[model samples]
Target: MAQVLEFRLPDLGEGLTEAEIVRWLVAVGDVVEVDQPVVEVETAKAMVEVPCPYGGVVTARFGEEGTELPVGAPLLTVAVGAAATGTTTGNGSSGGMPSAPAAGTPGTAAESSGNVLVGYGTGAPAARRRRVRPTASAPAARVAPADEPAGAAEARVAADIADDTEQSGPVPVISPLVRRLAREYGLDLRQLSGSGPDGLILRADVEYAMRAAGAAAPAAPAAPAPAAVPGPAPRPPAVPTPTAAPVPAAPAAERIPLRGVRGTMADKLSRSRSEIPDATCWVDADATELLAARAAMNAAGGPKISLIALLARICVAALARHPELNATVDTAAREIVRLRDVHIGFAAQTGRGLVVPVVKDAHRRSAESLTGEFARLTEAAREGRLSPAELTGGTFTLNNYGVFGVDGSTPIINHPEAAMLGVGRIVPKPWVHQGELAVRQVVQLSLTFDHRVCDGGTAGGFLRYVADCVEQPAILLRSL
Candidate 1:
């Protein structure tokens, strides 16, 4: 008999709690290999293809396309092992089906891939499913009892496995959010009976425990407690009061949920605004020399150098001179953490939303290498294939909003990072050059720095250095 296993959505790291099923790769009755990509899911960070850890025939899928599911929610089920076979005679007589594989029987193929996400799947072989004995009055069915509803047998078997897990090992909790909730309330997960499939602890279980604990707590003192005791008392139920006649109901408005990449951007921007006291300093630069230099380099080069690559090179040089701006504020430690590596992130707007893909070890990369990396990351971002690792750990962000045909913006600092450099569109403008008014390629550059990290002097110097490089590309060669 095949051992049916339900696969839950694995934790797609970086603190993501849930994902929207963008697409499913398998259907009911389809055979799947271990570690095969089963579904495409869109999380807050990026689009990811979740793999199934079992090799088997798919039995069911839990959610439809565009349906959002939490980290621990079931994604699908697979029936592992070989199916029981039987022979029948033409005379209405039948040979009995072969007995199911015995528990831990040698030569019996294992069912799991042993590959899984964090906090999921034990490395040990899957627990052997108990064989059901037939009653005197009832005949043994091939897969399940005739009267049992679809999936009911699977549920029972899963629950049995869960019971064994709960008794012998760690609590069956897959979601970090659920664990965090329990931790916050000082609730013992082992003490509470899980309400999720296979006795898996869920966020709801933790929340219910918290509510129960709150209800069972002793009433607060008659008056406010001393300041040492934190948290305000629970408000008493409000008394009824006379009110005016009920107003007519308003029409429902179309409300877009802040979720996926959009939601992540909103949260990060909001957090950056709330936590960082930021200041912006901007200046217009004569980029005519920079453009000519890039054109010249490309004309003679093996690999063409991009304008942004040149700008990035200049930024890296500027940062080396002003390392204070290339640092982050550590509020808890009361210190400014200067990062040694320059993993520069550049803002890219995709079909999904705005994203910042970081170029790791940027300080060590050449202009040609930076151009190649930026191209690769931008392409990945457009295709929604950029991983969470590619999207984070940015020590500083270089945003060229000039692509949007804008002059400049007070770019918000990508949080935990100390600063952001925004570049506006480089356009032809008349400027005083060599004692004469000449039309030059000019661009506006803005530096947004966390006030806690550095003051205006450092920020201005960094911007000034970048502007000088753009005005005279030779200045950047000195650092090179």
Candidate 2:
């Protein structure tokens, strides 16, 4: 006998409430080790493999691929301390059939996992002094899949019937689908109890309630189509009025749910637009010297310095001069909070989507170190392996849209932070050098800052300093 434990989806931090099942790594009846990558899920932030804390045989899985499950929904159940064969046929059984353990016997080996959420771990099986009497169960046959007898329809019917039971308080819903169904039908779920284990209100319960409500209500007659208009004027399309019969829906288009990495981006960008009262200022910079400086550094370098790192160095130096821009707007307290440290965020586009990876304590690192860190983070972002910590806590952002061949962008502030600096393509352009026109490496730089954090003068000062450094790289030596 073994204890069967259900593992629910853990909170994949950064305010993500749900995730879509991309793939299942372990199948039913498969033996799994503790902390093994069990399923691949796409959250609004990143694609991650969720691990189970228990080491044993997987018994039942809850959702299918492409299904969206809310946090706290069951991922799978495992029978820990049980053999991978899934049956106790040889121990005190008749004719090699699986049998129940004697009551009050210490025969069942069960272990409880302490690390069930973010940190998964394993240890030796713990023996318990208290035990449960083995009930009449089929051991491995404890799982009821969607393809069971009478199929999902029967389960829905049974669950719906159970939904009619009165509850003491609020209904327990495991999936967001159930709540959406009820809202669409205007069903008062407080009056109905749930049909699932522990009174969980499932999608079936909502649909059943919808059908019941529709059946109990009186039907209305359909309105006749309007008469045709005179002459060449086209008659308005006949509007279908509400009736007892549900109108068949048009064939669905290929729809992808906005719930994972893409969804998080949408949310963050939206919030940044809504909460941060921002403004953008741009200027063209002569980058001939900056590019030349980079070449010199690389040619004479122990560790090659990247152009982005040199730009980062300029940004850190500019922030030191214009400290007002390196701050956040404290809306709740109605104050501008200037930060002491400079953690920079750089936008990196990957196959998954656009991600902003932060370089911690960027003001303290040299150009060589910044180059190495950016390379590491960019690789992590492309592979979808960046942790939430690596993706957040930036006081300012450096977005080099130049890599994409763009000339300029009014970059939205990465929220809570006050400002972002966008750099554009550096191409050869005729410019005044020593009062004479000459071809120079020209780049456009844009700074988007929160109005609550600073005024245009401060922002202009920061951008101008950045431009000065680009036009004459030796200006950075003064700060160094």
Candidate 3:
């Protein structure tokens, strides 16, 4: 007796509702092992491969390819029993048996579900789907004499097609319906060269061919002597060339049918934007001294510190001075959430999307420690290994657009916090030094705040204080 087990789509993290199936590695009747990748699903931001949760023989596929499956939906059925150990055979009554086409046939389906893992069970039935190839039947006509060379006849046919195309004008060929129409009309594509890019024939070409063939032939008339020419004839107005039709616009506000990371991002961003009252303050910082100090620190066996790491340290110090910047506003209870620890979340661009991984107890950590953590977080982010804990629970957020060569932008405040700091690129500009103009490395900082929690003056002062710390790195050491 075989024991059947159902494999439902798991909650792919972040309370997502659905995920678009990208590809299936296992098909019906194929054996799969636990923790082996069985399917790839595309979330809104990136494609993630889901692994098999149980070891068994694949019995059924619940949905077809390209289907958007909701979470908790049964995706595949598996059999767990003695036969499931090896040489597993599935029940054939309920579309569970593989029906793959034989090899060497046109459009033969390929099977990917074999012994995918080393030392995995074998002798499972192959589960592959067949794809149909289209065939066309042309109208019967008298065959041309073989005396005519194929090349010359093809050229004449091409010229005739060109003439017809010129008369009918241009047409697009993106839709499947258009291709079907062309095939049904018995349009000789080789004769009528395509007008589209890369020589793709259009619907207009077929229509023109049909119309030209249907037109009445000229009637025979008697030839006569030419009449005397009249005075210069008036020139006809210039006719404008027809433009290609614009590609169909997507529906206004496409229903993304959100799932996975996008769904989570939407919920979080909406809550932050709607619940938080944001305000911003601007400050220009001269980073000449900060750059020199960072170079010295790096040269002296300290980890290579980026401007973002230095700024984060300065922000932590400033928050220490003014605890309000680090506090969260609870409008519901009319209270402030002042936490004892500071977790500075620095926004890092990752393969999945924009993620802010936190540096826990940022204020307590030394500059070198923060630098090491930043490096680890960035590496984890790029490798798509950041956990929920690493991504969440931050007293403040920082966005560095300077890497993309941007000067400054008012970054949207990542919620639960009153503000976020935007760091810009450091560039050398003219500045007054002891009443004399000299080149100095300057950077613009934009701090976006939640107005409900902080006034403009408080926000401005906090930014100024942070800038002061950056201008004097020794200030951070003294504050600590």
Candidate 4:
């Protein structure tokens, strides 16, 4: 007499209604241990491999790879019998036992029933369950320690084992897609903040951080000391930095279906544009003095700085004075969301997509620390390894299109942040200095604001203040 057991899919989290089977690690008639990885599934945000809860000889695979399954759908069946020799057969139609081969050779495997682990199982025809008993004792399934009752030391041990089994390092809650993206971009997953269901790191979270970091890099070069400003100034006309070629477009003009982070970004951007009416203001600032100041600072043994970081620091200092710019519009509540701390999100570009990673407490950090952190964040962002926390809680944003040789363009406000600043390339343009038309390093600045929260006066004033800071970088030291 053999006893039979069935395994169902477990919940992965984040209101996930369904999951597509990525691959099956085990086949029918294979002896599997409890907690062993048996299958991989792709959810809306990330891919995950699930472990088996029970130890038994696999009798059937409920569904094929790529099939979507619902929660509680039977995925596999095992016969628990006292004698190992008894053969069990399943009926091909809904509720029959799977057919078995002659004793000794591997048994014929059963087809998988398409069922999503979270929301709904496929409406495929059901398979009949064959009744069978087992002779060999099946080991009890392992459960997570965190889920266990209080005061159970055994649960703690189980939890430790579970953690080790699930994650390879400190941050084990990330999805497979995030891990893959992080690896491609050379990111360390543990360093990122998770924002997904149950605190899992999603793909969008990683991409956003990478983009922010990339946008902040070129600004550092604008900071070195006059003595350390290596190369002589360009003669008369300033030469533009060459831009990289745009990514090749897909041939045939075929429709590229959106999915994952790209799909989410499209939807979010669409919703933002539809819901939020935006207004922008522009200004031209002479960054020559600022560049000179940065060079002076760099000569003092400070970390190699960039114009972007200096700009970011100035923005944070200014936001402290003008809290209105750091607020979010609550249309439903008809209120404003004013944050206490200043976390400035910078736009970075990655191979997969664009990411905006936030630097927390920008006002408090030293120039050197911020510079190093900017490097770390951007490196992680470009590699697709940003965590969820890094993507959220941004009180403001900065977009640097200057590196691409563009003069300036209005950047869309990242929702919840009342305003965003766009910085363009610096060029030597003829400008009045002390009543003389002298050539100076001039740059265009654009400020895009959520009109509901910020008035034209407030927006323009903020840009003017930024211009003052950029024109006299020495003023930034006083603010700090």
Q: Which residue pairs overlap in candidate 2's backbone?
A: 43-260, 44-260
Candidate number with greatest TM-score? 1
Prediction 2 global C-alpha lDDT: 0.73
Candidate 3, residues 382-479, lDDT tens digits: the string is 87666666777898998889998999897777778877889889899998866999999988888888777668888888889888876777777787
Give Cα distance to truth, residue 379, candidate 1, Å: 0.3
By summed lDDT, which 10 consecutive residues of candidate 4 come out lowest?
115-124
Judged by lDDT against the true structure, how good is candidate 4?
A: 0.65
Q: Which stretches of candidate 3 lie over 4 Å from their true place?
A: 11-25, 40-49, 63-68, 83-259, 350-352
Residue lDDT tens for model 4, 370-405:
888889989877755666567667889989989889
- Every candidate's lDDT: 0.76, 0.73, 0.65, 0.65
The total number of steric clashes, by the backbone 3 Å criterion, in model 3 comes to 5
If scored against the real structure, what TM-score would every candidate get?
A: 0.67, 0.66, 0.60, 0.54
* Tens-digit per-residue lDDT, 1-480, candidate 1: 324578999889999899999999876545567778999999999999998877645657899998999999999976543322333334222222122333254443222223111122222222521212212222222233559875775465455445545565435454434554555566655565554333444555666667766666667679867667568987999999989999999868877888899899999999999999999999999999898998898899599888888888988999999999889988899999998889999999999899999999999999999999999999999999999999999998999999999998998899989999999999999999999999999999999999888889999999999999999999977998
**True-vs-predicted CA distance for residue 117, candidate 1, Å:** 30
Compute the lDDT of residue 323 as modeled in candidate 3: 75
